[model samples]
Target: MEVKMIGISKSFGTNKVLEGVDFELRSGEIHALMGENGAGKSTLMNILTGLHKRDAGKIYIDGTEHYFKNAKEAEEFGVTFIHQEMNTFSNMTVLENMYLNRELKTKLGLLDNKKMAAEAKKIFNELHISLNLEAQVDTLSVGQQQMLEIAKSLMTNGKVLIMDEPTAALSETEIDNLFTIIRGLKNNGVAIVYISHRMEEIFALCDRITVMRDGISVSTHQISEVNVNQIVRDMVGRDIGDFYPEKTTPIGAIKFEVKNLTSTGLFENVSFSVREGEILGFSGLMGSGRTEIMRGIFGIDRYDSGEIRLNGEQITIRKPSDAIKKGIGFLTENRKDEGLILDFSLEDNIVLPSVDEFSKRGLLEQKTIDEFVALLLKRLVVKAENKDVPASSLSGGNQQKVVLAKWIGIGPQVLILDEPTRGVDVGAKREIYLLMNELAQRGVAILMISSDLPEVMSVSDRIIVVREGQLAGEVLKSEATQEKIMNLATGGN
Candidate 1:
C-alpha cells in the first residue's frame, strides 16, 4: 500500500495549525512524524483518520483518491488508528472491547463469545502481552489497556496503521514487545505511521522521519541521516544542551514524612521521607499503588490509617484544600482531567492555586495577578501570544507548565509530581527537569513518581519501588539500575 497526503491545510477558528503540509508513507515501512507539542501532529493524524476534516488536501491510497467520512471508512480501506488517548469501553471485558464494532457472530446471528475470546488470546500471545481476556478493561493496568488498544487496531485487518505515542505508558519490556510486533507487521507489508517523542525509539524503529514545525512540513530524512540532537533542533528550532539539567543544591533535613500509611486495598504500610532540596523517585509497575500513595498523601483519596508530618509538625489533612494549606502540592497523573481547566485562560490556570494570594479581601487584584502571570511565563519560557488565550489553545508541554506553575505559585514545601514528563516532547521534558532542580534548590521537597526508568534513574537522588500495593525496596541513586529496579518491582530479592 502507498499513502500520500498532499497540500493538507487545517485550522481551528482563527489559528492556522497546519499549512499546506505534504507527506507520504510506503508499504512495508515505518515512517515517524516528529514535532513539538501542538505542532499539528495530532490534528494531522485526526484528519487522516477522518475524525477531523482537512480544509484543503488530497489523500491517495494505492494510486486512487480516497475520502474518509469517518473512522469506519478508513478502517474499511485497511487504515487503522490507535490514538494517544485510550478509546476503549472501560466497563466491557477485554475481548468485548477488542471486538466491539466487528464481533464474531454465530450462524444464528448471535455473538460468538468463544471465538472472540480465542482470537483475543491468540492476538495477545502474538504481541507478547499478558492480559486476561475476561477481565473488565478498567481492571487492567494503564500499560495493559494500551496493549489492548493496539490489539484492537490490529484486529481491523488494516494494511496501514497510525500509532500515536503508543508506547508512552509502556515499560521497557513492553516497548520491546511492541517493536517485535511492528517488525512482524513490516514483514507482512503493512505501512505504519508512528508519532513519538522518544528519539532513540524513532532511530531504532523507523525507516524515515518527517519533521513538522508550526504547522508546516520542515523536512523528511532517512533515520540513518539524523541524530537525536539534530532532530530536536528541527522540531523545536533550538538546541537543548542538556536533557536533564543539573541540580546544585545541598540536601537538607527531612521536610515531609509519611508513616504507616494504609488506604484499604489501594496501598498499605507506605512510609517514606523526602528532604528539602531532594528529588525522591517512586518507581513501580502500573497499578502498583504509586499514584494511590500520592493521592492519599495529598488528601485526594481518603486513607484509613497514616500520619503525615511536615517539617516535624504533624498535620491532619482531610481534604485537598487542607493539604494545600499545609504547603503540600500534587500534580495528578491525568493532566487533562485534574491539571487544567481547558476553558480557562492560561493566566487563570496558573493562578488557580494561588488565587487567594492575589486577592484583595474577597475580590481579585487584577494587576497583581497580571504581574505574577508575566513572571511565571518568563520563568517557565511559556510561548504564547497572550495570557488571555485559553489553556486549551496552548501545547501539551505548555499546559503541563501551567500545571507546574499553579502548584509552585502556591509556595509549597513539598511537591508530588506523578509522571511529570508523560506525553511531553523532548525539549519540554528538559525544561520540566530544570524546573524540578530549581524547585529543589529553593528548599522544596520533591517526590517524583514515574514509570520511565531512565528518567527515574537520572533525576532522582533516591529511588523507592512499590509492588502489589506494598513497599518493595529502596535504592540510592548510585545503585538504581534497570535490572535492580525491575527485580524489586517484580518481587525478586
Candidate 2:
C-alpha cells in the first residue's frame, strides 16, 4: 500500500498550521515525521486521518484518491492513528478496550466474550506482551497501557499506521519491545507514519525522514544519507550543539526532607532529602514508584505515614493547597492536562496561583497583574505575540516556560518537577536547564524525577535509584554512571 498527501493546507482562525505540505508513506517502510512543536506535524496527520478538513489538498491511497468524510471513513480505508495522549478507559479491561467499538458478536448480536478475549490474546502474543486480558487498564503501568494502545490500533489490520510520540511514556525495555512490534508490522508490509521528538529513535527505526518547519514541508531524506545533526538542523533551522546544558553547582544545607514516607501498596519507607541550591534526581524504571512518591510529596496523592520537614520544621500537608501555602510547587509530567489552563491567556495563567496576592480588600488590581505578568513573561523568554494569547496557542516549549512562570510568580521555595523535558526540543531543553541553574543559584531546592538517565546524571548534584517502592542506592553526580544507575535500580549493588 502507498499513501500520499499532497498540497495540504489548513488553518485555524488566524493561525496557519499547514501550508502546501506534502508527505508520503510506502508499504513496508517506517517513515519518521520530525519537527519542532507547532510545526504542522499534527495538523498534517489530522488532515490525512480525516479529523480535520484541508483547505486545499489531495490524498491518495494505493493510486486512488480518497475523500474521507470522517475518521471512520479513513479507518475503513485501512488507516489508523495512535494519538500522543493514551485513549483508554481506566475502568475497562484490556480486552474491552481493544474491542471497544467493534466487538465480536454472535448471530443474535450478543457479545462474544470468549472470541474477543482470544483475539486480544493473539495480538498480545504476536507482540510478545505478557499482560492479562482481564486486567483493568488502571491497574496497568504506563508502559503496559502504551502496549495496549498499539495492540488496539492493529485490530483492523491497518495498512497505514500513524503513531504520534508513541514512546514518550515508555522505558528503554518497553521501547525495545515496541520497536520489535513495529519491525514485525513492517515485515507484514504495514506502512507506518511515526512522529517523534526523539532523534535517536528516528535514526534507529525510520528508513526515511520528513522534516517540517513553520507550516511547510522542509525536506525528506533517506536515513543512510543523513544524520541526526542534519535532521535537527532542518527541523529547527540551526545546529543544536549540546543536547543538555552543563550543571555546575555547590550543594548547600538540607532544605527539604522526606523521612520514612510510606504509601500503602504504592511506595514504602522512601527517604530522601534535597539541599538548597541543588538538584536531587530520583531515577527508576517505569513503575518503580518514583512518580508516586513525588505525587505524595506534592499532596496530589496521600501517604499513610511520613514526615515532611522544611528548614528543620515539620509541616503537615493533606492537600495540594496546603503544599502551595507552604511554598512548594509541582510541575506535573502531563503539562497539557495538569499544569496549565489551556483556554486561559498567558497573563491569566501566570498569576493564577497567586491571584489572591493581586487582590485588594474588595477589588482586583490590574496594574499589579500587568506588572508581574510583563516582568515574568519577558523574564522567562516566553515566545508569544502578546500576553493575551491562550496557552494552547503557544508551542510546547513556550507553554512549559509559562508553567515555570506560574510557579516562579508564586515564589516557591521547593519545586518538584516530574519529567520536565519529556517532549521539549533541544533549544527549549537548554533554556529550561539554564533556568534550573538560575533557580539553584538563587537558593531554590529542586527534586527532579526523570527517566532520561543521562539527563538526570548530567543535571543532578546527587542521584538516588528507586526499585520497587524502596530506595535502592544513592550516588554523587561525579560518581554516577548509566551502568551503575541501572544496576542499582534493578536491585543490584
Candidate 3:
C-alpha cells in the first residue's frame, strides 16, 4: 500500500486547488497532512482517492503507476477516505450503513443481513465502540456517529485510510479510544493519511508529517524532526505570534442572563449570565447538553421553562427572527447546514440576517448590500476571490469567517459561538480569537461553547463546566487549569 504522488496539480474553473504537490504514504505508518483551510490538503487527498481528476500528476502505488476512476474504485483497491463531514445515511440503521453498496449475498442472491450485522458488530467490538446496530444513525449523537463512521471505514479492511478531522465531534474518552484503534491499524500494516488542524494530535499521534500551503507542498519531515512552530510557519508562511491573543477587554455589568432554562429530557434548570465585554466559556464532554443549551437560548429549540433577559430587561424570543430583532446573534456549531447556504453566493449568506436593513421600499439595494458584504469580508480577513462566489467555494476556516461576518453585520450586543474553532487551522484560529477580543472590547457579550480545554481556558474570561445537562462548576481564567476543567467536566471532586 505504498503511494507516491508527484507534481500533482488540479484546477476548477481557473481556481488552482493543488499545484506541484508531492506526498508519500508508506505501509504501517501514520502520515499527517497539515495545512490551513484551502491550502489543498483535502484536495490533494481527493486527487489520491480519485474523487477529483488530477490535471497534472504521477501516482505510483506499490511500484505500479495507477489512477482510480472513482472513490468506489479506490475503496475496492483498499483505500478508504473518511471525510470530516460524515457520509452516513441518517435514515438507515447502523448495520445497514456499514454494509451499504457492499452488502453480502447468500447463494440464492438474497441479502445477508445476519452476516453483515455480525461483521459490523465485530468491528465495533474491536474499536471498543458500544452501539446498537439496529438503531437509526440520526438517533445517535454526533460523537457516536463519528465513531460509527470510523467503524464503517474499518469494515472495508482498508490498507490505506484517509481520515479528515476524525475527532472533531468526539469527546476526550472517545478520542482516546479512537487513537487506540488507529494505533492498532498501523500495527497491522495499514497506512493512515491523517488530516487534522489540531496540532497536539499531529505531534502526539502521527509518525511523519507533510505540510501544504497555497496549493503546494511546503515541506515534509519525520514527526520527530519538526515541532509545532515549524509546522505552523510552513502552513501559514508566517510566524503568527501567539496562538491565543491576550484578553485585554474590560468586563462590564451583566448584559445577558438566562434563568431556569430547561428543555425536557435535554437540559434542566440551567442558569448562566454573561456581562458586557465578557467571554463566558461553556466546557463539557460531548452530549453534555452544551450545544442544546445554546440552541434553546438562540430560539432554535424550545425550552420548557426559561427566562432570558437582556440589558436588565427580560425579552421573549419565540423564534430566531425575534432574537435577531432583540440584538442577538448565533453562530451554530454545524456551520455548513445552519450558518451558511452552500449554493448561495458569499454576499447572499453574509447579508441574509441583515438583509432588511439594506433594503428600501420592498426592494433590495444592491449598492448597499455590496458595500456591507465587502466591509465585513475585509474585516474578517476572509480569503475569497469574489463576493459573488458561492460559499461552498471557500474553505472551512473561510466559511466560518463568512458565518462570523454575517453575525457581525447584525452588530448584536449578545453573541453565542459554539465550537467556533472546530476544524479550523492554527493561523485562522488566532485570527478568530483576535476578532473576539475586538468584539469584547466593543462591549459585546459572547457565550462560547468549546470542547478544546486549552482554548476554553485561554479565550474565555471565565469558564463554567457542564455535566449531563447541569452546571457542574465555574472557574476564572486566572485559576483555571486543564486538570481543574476536566475534573469539573467529568464530575470529579
Candidate 4:
C-alpha cells in the first residue's frame, strides 16, 4: 500500500492552519509527523479522517485518487486513525468498544456476543494487552484505554494506520509491547503514520520523518539522515535547550500534610506531606491510587479516615467547594469532563473559579472580568484570537492552559495537578514545567500525579510511590530513580 497527500490546505475562519502540506507513506514503512503545539498535527489528521474538510488537497491510495466523505468512507478505503484523545464509550464493555461500528452478527442478524468477545480477546493478546474483554471500558486505566483505541484501528484490517501519540500515557513496558505490535504490522505490509513528541520513539520506530511547522511541511528525511536536535529545531522553529526547566526554589517547611488517609477501595492509608516551595510527585502504576490520592486531598472524593493539616492547622474538608474555600485548587485528570466547559468561551472558563471576585453588588462587571482574563491570558500564554472564542476551538495544549488559568485565578495555597501534561506537545510541556516551578517559588505547595516517569523525575523535589492503595516508598529528589520507583509500584519490595 502507498499513500500520498499533496498540496493539502485547510483553514478555520481566518486562520490558515495547514498550507499546501505534502507527504507520502509507503507500504511496510513507518512515517513520523513531528510538529509543535497548535502546528496543525491534529487538524491535518482530522482532515484525513474526514472529520473536517481540506480546502485544497489531493489524496492517493495505491496509485488511485481517493475521497473520504466521513470516517466510514475512510474505513471503506482501509484508512484508520487512532486519535490522541480517548474516544471510547465509557458505558460500554471492552469488547463492545472494540467492535462498536462493526459488530459481529449471527445468522439471524442478532449481535454475536461470544464471537465479539473471543475476537476482542484475540486482538488484545496479539497486542500483548492484558485487559478483560468483559470489563467496562471506564474501569480500564488511561494507558489501557489508549491501547483499546489502537485495537479498534487494527480491527479495520486497514493497510494504512494513523497513530497520534499512541504511547503518550503508557509505561516503558507497555511501550515495548506497542512497538512489537507495530513491527508485526509493518512485517504484514501495513503503512503506518506515527505522530509522537518523544524523539527517541520516532528515531527508533520510524523509517522516515516529516516535519511540520506553522502548518507547512518543512522537510522530510530518512531516520539515518537526521538527529534529535535537528528534528526539535525543525518542529518548533527554535533551539530547545532543556526540555525540563531547572528548579529555582529551595524546599521549605511542610505546608500541606495528609495522615492516614483511606478512601476504601479507591485508596488506603496514604500519607504524605509537601513543603512550601516544593514539587511533590505521586508515582505509581495505573490504578495504583495516584489520582485517587489527589482526589482525596482536593475533597473530590470522600475519605473514610484521614487528617489534613495546612500550615500547621488542621482543616476539615467535606467537599470540593470546601477545599477551594480553604485555598486548595485541583486540575482534574479528565480535562474534558471536569476541567473546562467546552461550549463556553475561553474567558468564561478562565473566570469560572473566581467569578464571584469580579461581581459588584450582585451584578457582573464586564470590565473587571476582561481585565482579569487579560492578565491570565498573558501569564499562561493562551493562544487565541479573542477571549470570546469557545474553549473547544483551542488545541489540546491550549485547553490545558485554560484549566491551569482557571485554578490559578483563585490563588490557592495548595495546587494539585493530575496528569497535567498528558496530551500536550514538547514545547508546551516545557512551559508547564516552568509554571509549576514559578508557582512553587511563590510559596505554593504543589502536588502532581503523573504516569510519565521522566516528567515526574525531572519536575519533582520529592517523590511518593503508591501501590495497591498504599504508600510503597518515598524518595528525595536526588534519590528517585526509574528502577526504584517501578520496584515499589509493582510490589518488588
Best by lDDT: 3
> Candidate 3's C-alpha lDDT?
0.91
Regions of model 2 farther than 4 Å from truth = 128-141, 374-401
- Give the count of colliding residue pairs in each prediction: 0, 0, 0, 0
Q: What does candidate 2's lDDT look like per residue over 23-50, in tens digits?
A: 9899999999988777888778888888
TM-score of each: 0.93, 0.93, 0.97, 0.96
Tens-place lDDT digits, model 4, residues 1-493: 8988899999899988999999889999999998877788888877877889999989887899877899889887888888887899999988888888788899999999998888888888888878888889888777789989988888889988999889877877788889999999999999999988887789899999999988999999999999988888898889878988899798799999999999889888777888999999989887788877888777777899989999999999988988988889999877876899999999999888788888989999999899989998888777787899999898877898899999999998999999888777777788889999989989999999888888899999889898889999998879878999999899987
Instruction: Report the Cα lDDT for residue 177, model 2.
Output: 81
TM-score for candidate 1, please give it.
0.93
TM-score of 3: 0.97
Query: If ranked by lDDT, best first, what sequence of candidates would result?
Result: 3, 1, 4, 2
| Poorest 10 consecutive residues by lDDT, candidate 3 | 137-146
> Where does candidate 4 stray beyond 4 Å?
none
Measured over all alpha carbons after superposition, the RMSD of each candidate to the real structure, in angstroms, is: 2.3, 2.2, 1.4, 1.6
Clashing pairs for predicted structure model 3, backbone only: none
> Across residues 228-299, which tens digit of lDDT does each residue of candidate 1 receive?
888888988988798877777899999999999999999999999999999999998877899889989998
**Candidate 3 local lDDT, 1-493, one digit each (tens):** 8999999999889788888999999999999999988898888888898999999989999989999999999999999999887788999998888888988999999999888888888888887888999999978877788899999898888999999999988878788889999999999999999999998899889999999999999999999999888989999998999899898988999999999999999999999899999999999998899988988888988898989999989999878999999989999888877899999999999989998998789999999899889999998878788999999888877899999999999999999999888888888899899999999999999999898888999999999999999899999999999999999889896
Which residue runs does candidate 1 get wrong by more than 4 Å? Answer: 91-93, 132-139, 382-395
**Of the candidates numbered 2 and 4, which has the greater TM-score value?**
4
